[model samples]
Target: MPLYENRINALNTIEIDQNLLKEVQVGNQSVAKTLVDKIIENKATKIAIEGWYGVDFKKIFNLIKEEAEKHNLTVTGKSSAGLYKSSEEIAQYSAKYLTDDPSFGWVNSDGHLRDLLNPKALQELRDLKSESDLLVVYGPGVAVEELSDLYDLVIYADYTMQPMLWQMWDGELIPFGSDEPDKNYFWKQYYYNDFYLLYRQKQYAYTKTDFYIDAVVPEELKLMSFKAYEAMIDEMVKYPIKQVKIMQPGPWGAYRYRDLWDIKGLECNAWNELAGIELSILIDIGLEKPINILTQNIMQRPLELVGEYVHKTFPELFPLQVWLDDGYFPEPVPWERSSMPIHNHPSTQYVQRHFNEPLGRYETYYIVESYKGSSTWMGYKEDADLEEWERLCRDSDNLKVIPNWEDFIKRWDTNVGDLFLIPPGTTHGHGGNQMILEMDTGPSIAGTEYSFFTYDFARNTWDDNTKTMTAKQMKMHLEHSFDNQKWIREGRVRSHHRPRPITQAGDGKYRYDQYETIDEMPFHIERIFMEEEAPGDTQGKFMQIVTLTEGERVTIVSKRDPRLRTTIDRLQACVIPASFGEHTYYNESGRHAMVVILRLKKG
Candidate 1:
């Protein structure tokens, strides 16, 4: 029931407190009378309400008509070729007629799409631009801010498109090509239509558009170098192959049509390395011309440089591979070779590019101690970052999250002893052993261009003894680019001495806790534990929060406080928030009671 609906007693729905709206105006500038306020409005001569998330057709026409009428004119609703269903797609003869006019088109990823918008249909509307008419696009997540300057208007609401569309138009019908600035409004919209094959088949089956770099993910939960892969292959048996259309949507299927349900055999000899498993599948619609990204946290790609990259990788794939470049990706001011970028510019916003709904990513990674002989001052970062993974996984069903094979992999890697990438949302150094040799890049962990790395480390060279960035070296380099004040104040290097206590729930079995994180970032740190027989206090316990799967190890086998402790080894993480104490874990058996400690704060 709507909160407003429960006026009889306590309300649990949205009751528009007329006064509250005034307060909201001051409190949250981003929100207005409606949800989305259009940040940019360019008057296009011609266009179509082809589609976008949460939009309505009648509402679209009404808005356009109202805007047009304001100019003593009314919108002449012309049906573009694919305005409803492309005439070409429906009636073979009609297909040529509708498609002949390039102004209108559809978003199915089959091969027929010409440009982001069909060109022919647009030409017809060009005349209106000169007359000062406005073309209002009806779509969801179609934020003009996130894409390569596409629509003049956007309706950006997560769920309902109708109310938002009306509010932006203000009970008026706006026509295409209206250059009226004060009257126009909307939030930057975002659309994942380009990334899904499932959306392609039912509607615009033959229209294939070019895939862009906006879809590439910059960070992995944990890093897997050639060595880690080799170790994993040796330990795990070759899993059998099976072809099954998944019960749910998967990463591979989200991008292309034929890829919709083609998950086939998992080959041990995956890709170029025997270290990973390569599954067999085919693209459902467009066979994307593959490209790599030196992308940053924001998915920003310099427009010119993006072209250069595509030219390099897909020489044969050529200009046809396609891409959109947003100038948002941030790079080190003075490029640093000695260390990784303090704050990576790779774009999580690029997740918007995946026509694949529910697929967004936030990534952060760091170091842990190495487990070498006789406490030889060596140990690898633990692979089971239980606190971090749990949180990210908990919201798995919400965002178009990729499948959690990584979660299981992290656990398995833990038991067998291998380091995995830290889950995308954690700034972790397993519990309290702060070692040298840690590098990470993630989404907006902070609101500004600040990335915090500890410059204090014992070692400054790689295993081969080549000079590498010590905690000090990395810090010195970052000082040139970052505003260190915040780095010092908000995102200072983390350690046990400054351990931020994050509370979580425990049923004497599952334990976890909130880790610290910064604003503009969406991840929290957490700890987890399980133990069958507690280690003696004298020897000290082994607490690690690595990302590998602890195969066959139940919550009972691994135990710890699931809170931030510099002492224990083997911690697991889920993306739980701190302050609320939402991250906790535990294990049974007093003799082997396990404690898993972790930390979390919004990042």
Candidate 2:
């Protein structure tokens, strides 16, 4: 039998003020009508529709042009693409940041939106602004600093990440300066160069845009004034906010998600619960359905959302990631095919030197639910053969022979509420038959794909293209893995990584205990066992991630403001901002509750 039914609730929505909701206009026609009215009222001739990379600027421009033509006015416009650098120039300039490997690249720091624009074409466009009733500029980077004075009214077009990825997968997106989509190099270039360039552009546009448009759905565009957009973000940070969860299947995916979530057609491997760079948040604005906004946008109020130290440290970057690893299966499965690939992450100095990222990937796995044979793999065995293990891994990759991983790696029997700290250089993977809450440091704004895969136990994965299972031989970074490997043996793993919990505070009703972590780890883990209620505080320093591992339901409320609160069900998590200083947890169900809390260490 499965551990739970299909009770997974992935919606993360917050209700906002209705007055602001009324200001939100739906559909391109309505938004275009509003913009046309604004142009007439202000007697504006120059208009700019600046957009993020994936926005449909052509659709918006056409709608506005139609609306302007209705007023018996002449409208002339051009896409920002005309001002972009040549394709060869862009590829040459981006070569240093991108890597030979298709999956990885360094975050760009050397180029800006203006750097990508041809000065000659820019001057031509500026000079071409005519005496028509409306002179319009549309596309990404149209509102950049160089073109700031080119428009009298600026509207910023935005979309969420999921739809953008879908467009990328469908080959609908063409990279800047390139006429056609290069499937081979699109992901790396977009993540490393395009994302950062547009991110910086959006920051500047935020200050100057008179209106913001949610173009996630092209046919049904949502438009609001800059004031309303700012008000929405301000209201979001006032309380706990949850990011919309995204689930993915893997070669070693388990069947638990099939039972837990209302999803079909794929086995679930992991849930990206709080992956700030990858996921978005749903905002309830008294609409038929909640509007989706990128999770990183909430960081506009960095100090309020993440606190003083984190705001100073990360600076517009959401520094944490949370994932739920599904490992439950009703029937027995082969250990090789059921386990995760043996992998290790880079250290801070190592990542800085190699990838030009800000922080290293530090991770922890809190076992939320476990069955009879649940296990976790961490480090190496005390008596393992290192040289033979390396040879076998290479043979598995090159010769199609599965290596005896148990001979080299150590395994521990995991139980619910057990916390395992995995610092960089410490090899780790999740064994089957359990559910794990993986909390880790988000290393970059581009997205965290830093796990250096070593061995995959020679499994077969489903291929969407072929409609059949195919041999899954994942690329391995053995050289980097060996360089970062600490070779933590069984003794050190038991003594250092899995320290026994010490009671920090307790009363007759509730008990709070702190789990001792390794000195190198940057975050702290604690659990609260409550019979009815428990008190907590963020102290105005660090943000807190609260997950109900063993509770039916619990309500987290702010003591200062009783109106500010959210209820989380079993296995559901919510982020408590650092500004939510003092809060209390009330167990909604008349049963014992266990909540795991994670926070970054104070410097």
Candidate 3:
């Protein structure tokens, strides 16, 4: 039986007040009827329904058109694509940022929705208002500044990430101004250009829109007033927040997740606890079902959520990521099948120069559970042959030879609660037979691809579609790996990366020990053990991401306001916002609770 429940009611939820919840309308018919009533009551002439990239604007437009026809009103609708520039022009402009790299692209920083618009088309769209009694401007970018005055009432339709990704995969997601999806640069353009522009548009829409609609399920649309949306967000920031966990199966996956989580069918490898952008937040507002929104929505109040210093340091981004690397198996398996590919993340300077990213990837692994023969591989042995290792990696990439990775890599025995700091350029792999809690500095949108894979021991990967092992060689970026690789020997790896923890502060009921971290590490890890409870304070400086490593359950509550509290389960993680000051951890399980706290080091 799985020890952890896949779904926890308290996690990733914001309870909306009853008064505000009463205004939320469920189902597409209810939402469409309400909008039609509003138009009739206010005698609104022009209405704009702006949506996220993957929204079904045709369905929404038809619904409203049907409602208007019943009232004997002449309704005419035009997609916002009419106001967009030609597909060729948009592609040419996006080419600068989406340089020929298939796996990487530069962040389109200065690009806006207006850049993709045509002045002639904008004027044509403006002229449509006089032709019909109800002029409906629909689709993405309809709420942009250029068209802000064109609409009497603006509705912002939002979609969740999972459905959006599925739509893109199904080849149904056509970019604005394009009749068909870009077969070659479909994903690249969406991430770098389309998603970025739409996200910025949504941020602006949050302020000016009259209503917000959850269009994740096209048939079951949820409509709420803009005031209700703002009120829900205001209440959300006052407490700790967690994200829905995302489980991914990989070739090097182990058996621990099969037993720990209630996941079926797929072998779980990585459990994303609080990964930015990749996860969704579930908001509860006394509805039949919770509303799912992008995890990035929490950044709406950056200062209150992450603090001023962090907000300024990593503008418009979450600065940390938390995940579980499951490597536990009941019995020992072959090293090639269980071990991760020998890879290294890029340095801050290297990424900034090459990828135009904000920060580098710095990772740490804290052993949550370890079985017999559990180990972690990091750095190179003192007697390692650099030239031979490089040659083997290159040959392996071509599927010509298999490298004996053990000869060059250094392995360290992992124990529970042991912290291993993995800075950039350090070649590392999570050895099987242990469950590792991986906490790392969050990567920017484009920075997520900075993990330059060096070698994979010439192993085949598991093909989910075929349900069999396939002979697929992993892609190796040897040149980048060689340039960024640090020549840390076994002695240096043990002395510098692994350090003893010293007692920072303690009392009769609790104890706090601070782990020694190197200067290269921007974050600090501390262990808090509580017999009954332990008090903590963020000092309004930085956000604290915590994992309840031990104990059945623990409640994190604000000392000033007890009502503001969230309960964390064993092996589950949550973020204590910077604004959530003077909090305490109460051990609800009556056991000695152990909590691991990760935060940016004070400047």
Q: lDDT (0-100) at residue 141 of candidate 3?
A: 84
On lDDT, the stronger of 1 and 3 is 3
How far off is residue 320 in model 2, in Å?
1.4
Q: Which pairs clash inside model 2?
A: none
Clashes of 3: 0
Give the per-residue lDDT of model 1 (tens digit) for 1-603: 000000011111112224322222111111211122221133333333333222234444454465456455434444322222242333342232223312221223232222233344444334334333444443321222223244433222111222223344453322222222224322211111221221222123112111111111111111112132222222111111011011111111111212211223311100010000011111111112211111111111112211233224322111100000011112222111212212212223332232111112333332222221101011112453544533443343222232442232211111111222332222322211111112122211111112233221222222112222222222222221122112121122222112343545545543444444545433333334444322211012111222212222222121233322211112222111111111222222243333322211211
Compute each candidate's TM-score over C-alphas.
0.24, 0.94, 0.94
TM-score of 1: 0.24
Q: Residue by residue across 48-158, what tens digits does model 2's lDDT show? A: 998776788888988999999999989988788787998789888888778775557777865788888999988887788487889888888778888788788999998
Q: Where does model 1 exceed 4 Å of error?
A: 1-203, 206-343, 346-362, 366-491, 494-503, 507-510, 532-603
- Model 1 residue 589 CA deviation (Å) reads 14
lDDT of 1: 0.23
Model 2 spans with C-alpha error above 4 angstroms: 1-19, 178-182, 464-468
Q: How far is candidate 1 from the true structure (C-alpha RMSD, Å)?
A: 24.0
